[model samples]
Target chain A: MNNALPRWVDYGLMPLISVIVAFVISGLVVLFVGESPVQAALLMAKGAFGSGYNIGFTLFYATTFIFTGLAVAVAFHAGLFNIGGEGQAYVGGLGVALVCLSLDSVFPWWITFPFAIIAGALFGALWAFIPAILQAKRGSHIVITTIMFNFIASALMVYLLAGPLQKSANLGPRSRDFAEGGQIPKLGGLFRPLGIDMGASPLNVSFALALIMALVVWIIIWRTRFGYEMRTLGISPRAARYAGMSEVRLVVLAMMLSGALAGMMALNPVMGDQARLQLDFVEGAGFVGIAVALMGRSHPAGIVPAAILFGGLYQGGSELAFDMPNITRDMIVLIQGLVILFAGAMGSLFTPAIVRLLTGVGVMPK
Target chain B: METILQLLDLTVRSAVPLLLACLAGLYSERSGIVDIGLEGKMLGGAFAAAAAAAVTGSVWLGLLAGIFVSVLLALVHGFASITNKGNQIVSGVAINFIAAGAAALLGNAWFNQGGRTPQLQSEQRFNPIELPLAETLSSVPVLGPTYQQLISGHNLIAYFAFAMVPITWWVLFRTRFGLRLRAVGENPAAVDTAGISVSWARYRAVICCGILCGIAGAYLSIGVSAGFVKDMTAGRGFIALAALIFAKWRPVSAMWACLLFGFLGAIEIRYQGVALPVLGVVPVQLMQALPYILTVVLLAGFIGKAIPPRAGGVPYTKER
Candidate 1:
């Protein structure tokens, strides 16, 4: 397969083509609703990238997706599908809330941030631990268990936020606002001095952290011996078993790593943007991670840009919602589904055609 | 006794969609194609049925619309996995998102009721059909009201759901197509060697799945509720998936499993705010989470094994 299509074509051109196809289909959907897709596209473009504020919002969303997309990518590399990122992110936010509620009054912002990171990751990993252990030791299909866990996570969050965590009896399922130290300053101030005015945007240092994690993830996945063993297991479980790789050890570690990255997504929302931890803040970003991971081919380098692209769609879709009374944010979700359909599921349809075209054009030997 | 009877009646209504979906899963998985998109198809079907009924003022048209849209989505899944040899799970996931997103988007766009269709009239929905002797028999002994409340007065779809259990069993075990379908799931190579088209059998099986899921969706909206609500399936498709696993993919056992889950749901509704002896006031979340938790426990083989078909989840590459 690799011999038929080069890595550049596989990673770059193929995904770009899939995205275009998805957008075209989405345009048809827009057309069905009696809206002009061309105008909608222009509105989306202006909405996503027309202003510094929009760019900041897009980056903020990308920062969250970067964590979740990497989470899915890590698990994918280990031959596991962790759809429970939603649950894990929710729990991770819970961990952040606990850290802030307990220590924010005493500690400074810098000190509180580190503990929140650890708490979030630890909690997220812990949420995924049961499903991983079940898959490794009990042969409970990881996909089903993770999905069940997602529902369970939603239930658990409702229980906690609506019952135990709700300090004010009159308020909705939400917690008390965090103190000053708990809420990190936006990157708007940091960017203004650099001539990039991120006007009143929620973008924070989490974007930088996401990039750093990407570098760290790249090193771990490609450079480490553990990565080699994990990839081997993913490629062929039989061969990995023959080589005496510990399925339990590798699976648990890989899932925990995946879970931790998902957990870190809370930093962008609960800590970075929202001053208070609330219900449904993760929204569907966890699911969007699946689309990002597939489109990116489970590579960090690909994932970063893919995350931003989805982030742009999300930011733009909200903007479109206000202008187009008929169109909604669900249109973006439709695009997400189309992307996954083209890039992940039916991607094989493109391979042979690409090979034939390349051969016919005399670009490659037959 | 009246409360108990009413609980039993509610169980039947609640179990119908789960039963439909569980049986739908049975056909696809037995044919060796994992159908994680059952929820999506059901959701899509529910919305389509409700919208169609709202517009046409006919329940049958709604059911047809539901089945048509579901089959269309199923064909898309078939094209992706069966034809293109792509990842079935990924395709199913994509289908789930697409159906859900499309249902909501189209609903809001068309009706403008925040993703809900108009309030359906009695003629546009499947109202309960009272039996011939239901009213007359209600004043008699124990068997009288029981027959009236428990056995009778359900919409036509509920009876159809129960009838499907035996029908599905017969189709999967007794018929020639069933033999070929089961064979394809178990060993497509053997089927191919025998000159039967593996793709054709799987495609037919997928269509059957689409029809059942379509009915399940219709049961949710027009049959049970007055109109469609966003996410009205409310994870029932996944619960049905759990029931399919709980029943070990057998049609008869699937019915019993759905009944059990439905009974639990009834109990949850009956005891929403009530207190129990040891547990105190049970949380609604706990009751809601129990099915998923039990499914995980069951899948771990703590109680018994739930092994899938031999070739399930694997794409059949002809040369291989």
Candidate 2:
């Protein structure tokens, strides 16, 4: 029985337990809001997966989060909290849109897409490198600097949207739409040969790209000399320095890679699907990725499931609200909050007891 | 000069909530609990106060409720950080996200005003109190004007906020409990060896933070405005944190830091309509970005020397 408890609490059930706790806490919120929790859950399920279109929309949502989650997890492995994902993504989208607008007629679709991706990655790398260099050279705290970067990016984007990038035709504060050639093709028609039309979901080739990127991250993190250096530095910077690893270079490189992954998210939704960079292109996907990264326990592969779950919440919550009057889109935000709270608290809530139980046995080293 | 005096008055009024929050941060952080969740606790208190006032038509009771809920969150934070030895930053982040989401959720249900509460009447909110002594002192000179403008025409909460600075300094330095608390923050092992529980001292500090943050939040919704808005604390918690660092964890200096930021905020808001002819139209975005720009510059320059406690983020685990 003692060993059973430890076995039962393995990594497999971690996300499950986290989800259960999230549901319970969010259920209380629903009760407070005077809505039946069961009905709300049912509606969310129906909205998220009722039709093939809903499932496709869910995949579209997942694609962006997966990139962001990977970005966050990469930094987490290197012992950095890059909350500047939002800023990086914003800049990346802007860079891509600028590229698309300037080169739409000159370059073919293949060339233009590659150019947009490169622009995004470069801008994201530059955005992250500033704080990374500051932390490495000046002993500046990464968390504070990255958080400040988020605000700066928000203000910068707001200013640009309201002034320079303001669409001449639309009265609202949004940028002009990209040309038709920039839009990513839908996968439903391609899959229709096998009678697999996934309906109206925006899930595209980006989903496949996200999966490939996850594998690349996993390999880069686990099988390379740079990965070893990063893990060591994350655990102990002084130790890594003694081992001949350059803290300055590694910090900058880690942040660049992180930003590069985050930048790819812009390709998924903003550049690929929307074919334009509007003010709400990413729509807080960067911040939401933080919650996904935490719940995924900062693993590249682990983040895919976490991202999809959150994406489901977004897609489903929107659908539920459209179907029902009482349940609003804000419920999804509440659920995200609850999931983060539970996941953060989980380590403290059970780790000590589990440690004790496992240590007494032959299974664990004391 | 008249505009300067008016601006000074506005600065004092604006400085109140931030000053109180900085003191709250000072108390908790001095004892080793990094209370970044001050923003969340403040939101909780603000929402509670606004709702209670709207329903009961009693601002005093509403303010009391705000204090109570803020302290409750402080206790929760203390338990999580001190007792469970959880990550302080993560705990605070969760609290912030929870408060943000919860407030909006509840507001949607209760008011149906789209994530905001209904505006209460003037009588249902706290109003500024003008001093009778200001009339007699109006003729005294520049000093008289300074006193009248800076001190006499602020809400009750503003005056109370000023009083908290010295009170905080006294409690943090003069008292035995404060000494032990500071000791725990700097070196918990030493405090533990001295027969005091590190967890308990830290818990007490967090509770102090909660009460102060509650007052700060109440001042926002009741003393400053008539209603509660979604995410209305609006990065003020972070400003309080910056003020805490700029003061180098000293209560008295922290008060001055609050005033500096407060003055900046007041100027930004007041300068919106009344701009210099040469400058033309001043965008609200610039003003919104002002405090953040100031924070980045201040932290990057003059306050780089400020060091956090040695064990600020590391949780204390007692080996019994």
Q: Model 1 misses residue B15 by how many Å?
A: 0.9
Give the alpha carbon lDDT tens digit for every residue of B178-277 in model 1: 9999999999999999999999999999999999999999998998899999989999989999999999989999999999999889988888989978
Per-candidate TM vs. native? 0.98, 0.92
In order, candidate lDDTs are: 0.92, 0.80
Candidate 2 docks at the CAPRI level of: medium
Model 2 TM-score?
A: 0.92
| Native contacts matched by each model | 0.80, 0.36
Off by over 4 Å in 1: none
**Model 2: colliding residue pairs:** none
Per residue, candidate 2 scores C-alpha lDDT tens digits across A1-366 of 224444445544556677787888888878776788888888888877777778788888998999898898899889888878988988888788788888776766677887888888888888888789878877667776777677777777777887888877456767677776676667667667866668766888778878999999999999999988998999898899899999999999999999988887888877667766677677878878878888887887679989888888999999877765556787776677666666765355755665676677766776
Error of 1 at B182 (Å): 1.3
C-alpha RMSD over true interface residues, each candidate: 0.8, 2.0
Worst 10-residue lDDT window for candidate 1 chain A reads A189-198
